[model samples]
Target: MKILIPFYSTYGHVYKMAEAIAEGVEKVEGVNAELRRIEEAIPEETLKEIGAFEAQKDFAHIPECNLDDLKEADGIIIGTPTRFGNIAGQVQNFLDTTGSLWMEGALIGKVGSVFVSTASQHGGQETTIRNLHTTLLHHGMIIVGLPYSFAGQGTIDEISGGSPYGATTIAGSDGSRMPSENELEGARFQGEHVAKIVAKMTV
Candidate 1:
């Protein structure tokens, strides 16, 4: 079984979470995890002006995902930084190209999950993930989330992000904060949980 993790990150927080999720997916026997990048929509000059060019280079070597990648995978986990309470434009652009898949029902019966990063504790993580679910539903996917069973999500010991909707991390306003260990653990759990579901369904 194959699980494809496609993500977009402006400052690497989402990328870190993606790596952790991939780790979890790989824990399942007979499952393979692949990390992919959503194509950037921002112009090179604009990215440089916004100081994100250099940070993005860290994961630039990861292969860019295409629609075929979505069709071929048994499960998919998406990661993106929240953009104004929703998925980033790059993620939107990538998902928008899946109309053909929807027409052919290519993704129907697949497992779909998402994770996100936001600039603050309440920066719309749940809403962002919920919106991503809306898209997956349109593709007829089986939605999976970071269920409450992940005990770390219920703790108030540290300011962290993890909801029943999905795993998330809070980036500082200036984008300095990375995903904490707790948030990454939630992401891993979600990934493993989704992979297990796909394994059963595919088998």
Candidate 2:
């Protein structure tokens, strides 16, 4: 099984979440996870929006990936840094371009999951996950999320990365907190669970 993990990261917090989720997917035998980034179109006012000094930084530019990677993926897990309780504009923009894929039902029956990073405890992680789910549902994809059996289920009040909705990470207000061991373990378990479901459905 091949799973595509595609996302956009602003502060690199979401990138870490994607790596942990990919680690989980790779744990399953015969499953492979590919990480890809979405490229942003150059804006006419890029320097004005980002400042000339900041535009020179590598992080200032978005990377590119082939859309065929998404088409060939048996499963897809998307991650993004939360923006006002929704996916980042770049990620949303990429999904919006999948209208042709949706028309062809290219993503139908594939397993899909969402992961997110938030700057605050109440920064709308769940809302962002739900919004991601809405896009997957439109493509007739199967959605998977962490179950209550995971070790972190209902255990941590500080950060509940495990959700029935999907996996997530809370980066804290200062962006210092990384995903806990339990959260990483739970994310891996979620990936394995989704892969198994996809295999069974394909059979």
- Give the total clashing residue pairs for model 1: 0
* Per-prediction TM-score: 0.98, 0.85
Question: lDDT tens string, model 1, 61-82?
Answer: 9999999999999999999999
lDDT of 2 by residue, 78-190 (tens): 88878899998889889998998998999998889988888776799899999989999999998888777775757755555657777777777776677777667767777
- Write down the lDDT that model 2 would get: 0.77
Clashing pairs in 1: none
lDDT agreement of model 1 with the native: 0.94
Cα displacement (Å) at residue 203, model 2: 3.0
